[model samples]
Target: MGSPPWAADPAPASRLPATNLLTIEYPGYIRDTSDSLDRALVSLSPVAGPRVDAASSAYALAHLTSLLERGGRVVECRLPSGSGVPDAMDLYKHPILGDVTPSDHVVVRVHRQVWKRMVNGQEERRKHYRIEVLGASSTCIRFRRMADYAFRPEMPAHASEHPTMKLHKILEEMDVAAMHAHRFMPEQEDYYDGQGAQRRSNLAMIPPPFFNRQELPFYYGYRQNPTSSLQTVTFASTSKRSRRTARKGDADLLDAGNDHAEVTRYLNRARWRNMAPVAVKFTEDGPVPTEPDAMLAQMALSERQLAYLERLKKHLSERPVWSRLSLLNQFSVADARALVQTKELFALVAYTFADGPWRDALVRFGYDPRQDMASRFFQRIHLRGKAPRAPTTRGAFKAEYGQASASGKAAPAVGDAQARPATHLFDGQHSTFSTSTFQLCDITAPVLLPLIHAEGPSDLRSAPDITTGWYSMSAWEAIRSSVSKSFHALLSEAGPHKTSEEAIESSEGSGAGDSSEEDE
Candidate 1:
């Protein structure tokens, strides 16, 4: 019934006064020997921001706290005999931020800590890579090969031996197996041979609630006819009349008001900062039967498919809103197959929408997509395994969506024109495993129509899920502890430990905290 040892006392937020020194506890460092390891630490002087005040009640520490909030895991590591100090440069960069190099020691530290967490009965829900070092003839040599890939040595197949690359290959094999398992399901075949099979594609936009809101922008609002399902309406403004009229037409019309703030913020960021993803194409093949799956099963010949496709022109027209289809156009066969294994259609679509075509598309359609904000969006989704609920208050919005760098300026946005949309993160070879994208859609039918047509109240249930919260609670606790112990100690007179009297009174309130990083 008591709190866990990992849990902090219900300390006052104002308990700590202000300080300028920022100390970062990096993930554990690697030991030279298999049996030992060292934990890295780096302290930043003259922390970024205005002059601090001692009377500011720990609030002035926000600048450093934000950075630490974005930092990686806090681990306790023991050093082996005569191990050198970890490079302070590595200590300064968070693993997720691309500051550290791929050395055998770093890889081992990452791997060992990851394995320890997994074996300790902690559940991992986020998508990531896992490197296996157990039972190898030589762990150092095996990891060194992995380091080659990590450091981008042009050693041909040797680079593939790197842990990151090897992990990617292992996942690739698993993905191939999954795609094969789902091969019998009805969908278009992506053939590489020049057999000249008629190729047709369709695209539709799944708005919020049904689609991952993290990926897609809620830009346009839809109005459905209550009298008949055949007629639909589209509105492009933020007004009460529009809302009232939309409700009259279809009570389930997605409330733009619900997503207005987030959409507006990103739209502004895109317009001002020019941080956008590639544009989504507006082309379309004619629509087929509303029941595309049923129609696809019966289309025995290319002629019948063409006939059904032509019939779709009556209902299908180019209604341009940012979409995931654009992103998918960039997905490689291997990537698609890999994503299919997770069977999380929402995640697949969301990732595509967030970075692929949707970012720029949102810009073209009157939204600002901040590269920094967009990066944060994807990172949190990866860490939390779900999107944060859009906060209701202006204060909540800043608190929830504020940048970790807290630089008071936007993170520089880069044009991904030369960047391959098919791959992201880690030398453009390893995609972020934060979410899954493997779903089979009948290329022969309307893709977004079915997703957009969810029935009843289920459509508006776009809030953060309870399952993701529970699974990620431990990670959140670890972060909270860092703030309490590290930052709090810096600002407060009381340190991370309790006195004898305090310990006895709070002895029952103790349990182990799961501080290990989640492996893919």
Candidate 2:
């Protein structure tokens, strides 16, 4: 097959430009999550992509062989761990902690046999299900039972001016019950009207431009007339001198560069864009699905006497941690939320193709996914616009409602930027930070690609608009360059247009045909 035009290595394009480095900082109540184990693990180069640590579960099903002074051995469940990385957490064990061996302070190695056996265990059974299906797994049904216990949005009775703290209090009290939702789906604008498009859009194949969210000011807060975001940073894989500094197995960083362009605006400092977004939920062509009521049945915010899914912050908070993590049953949720916000803020940036700072960060810190890499970086963030808040009153809230707050607001949104962010999240000397350079395209594309390529949900391709032409690199253009020269190259190279209007069946009773029209 002809080379996949859109495919590019995620690194510098062999040449070095000294002007690429940039320092971006922001001002506002920002919550950073690299400190948390769960989030920190996402930054690691392990797993399918960045994901929740295998060990960061509601319970760590460790098998303990404890021996008392009497020389009797007993086993029991260990307290669930909050640490995020499965690899790091895999190191510490109660036996190791309780070891009476002479090399007490040493980081003794656990046998691979023992380690595998310890982390090994079946997931929780779906006892939480409303009803058990003969073939359904336990994990499948528990959300129905556990919904009441997850985080619900929390709104305070009295209005508060601190934005960060208010968000912190609100999230802490909310129940973000878990769901088995398929995350990011790419727009297949890059597809070269060939078998790929005919069989499935695989969204990534379609070509489009990126949206500069700063264009819309709500997420940016008070920022305005921000500097143009430096555009695509191309990385070369075989630079003689570049290899001088290349890591042992480093690949081209260009693809990562392209992907970041789609996501960086969300991470750009809010001071540049000046906006605010109230809620986040996950959705599709229609409205976002209501969370399972079971997960919403119990929540931490409800215990605080606050209303559910409520936002009471009118100002930034002095305490960043509180705004981020105090609310979730698992540390992963809070960490994921914080990363999403940071990414959204970065998205606001408008990059100029000539010199992209976003590219520089990747260069300094490579984003290649190696299982052994200690410090990995993840730029993917998901967000969605929430429905308008329903009218609410403090008086209507019921004491026994079982919801975090009884305000009756609509559910918050989840994003697909897998839509990534902006904001000062904090005040600093500069609105941005200077970090290692990267292969932006590689980072963004490879992650979503599975959804964009061979096996992604087909519908995921057509609906979401990736705004490809707007991107400076036009990685799509580069990809298309490999495919053909013209905008309608596929029409010329493959065959005639053969407009589907002539082929589509017009039977009036065909609901499936009507749905296809809706998709179109």
How does model 2 fare in lDDT? 0.24
Q: Could you tell me every candidate's TM-score relative to the true structure?
A: 0.14, 0.13
Steric clashes per prediction: 19, 152
Cα lDDT listed for each candidate:
0.28, 0.24
For 1-520, candidate 1 gives per-residue lDDT tens digits of 9889867767533222222232223324544753332122211222211221121313324533553557532221211113443321122122211121212232211333333335458766444564542221111101111111011212122223333233333444677764444322133244322466644221111112121212223447775434333323343332345345454435555556453321121112112121122222222123211222222234233563344333222212332222332233333333333323322321211211323312222222222222222211212211212222334434422232222333455854222222224212111112222222211111111222232232334332323222222113444343323222222221222223333223222332443222222322
**Residue runs of model 2 more than 4 Å from their true location after superposition:** 1-287, 300-308, 312-429, 434-463, 466-520
Question: Please, what are the lDDT tens digits per residue for candidate 2 over residues 426-474?
Answer: 1111111111111212222222233213222322222222222122233
Decoy 1 TM-score against native: 0.14
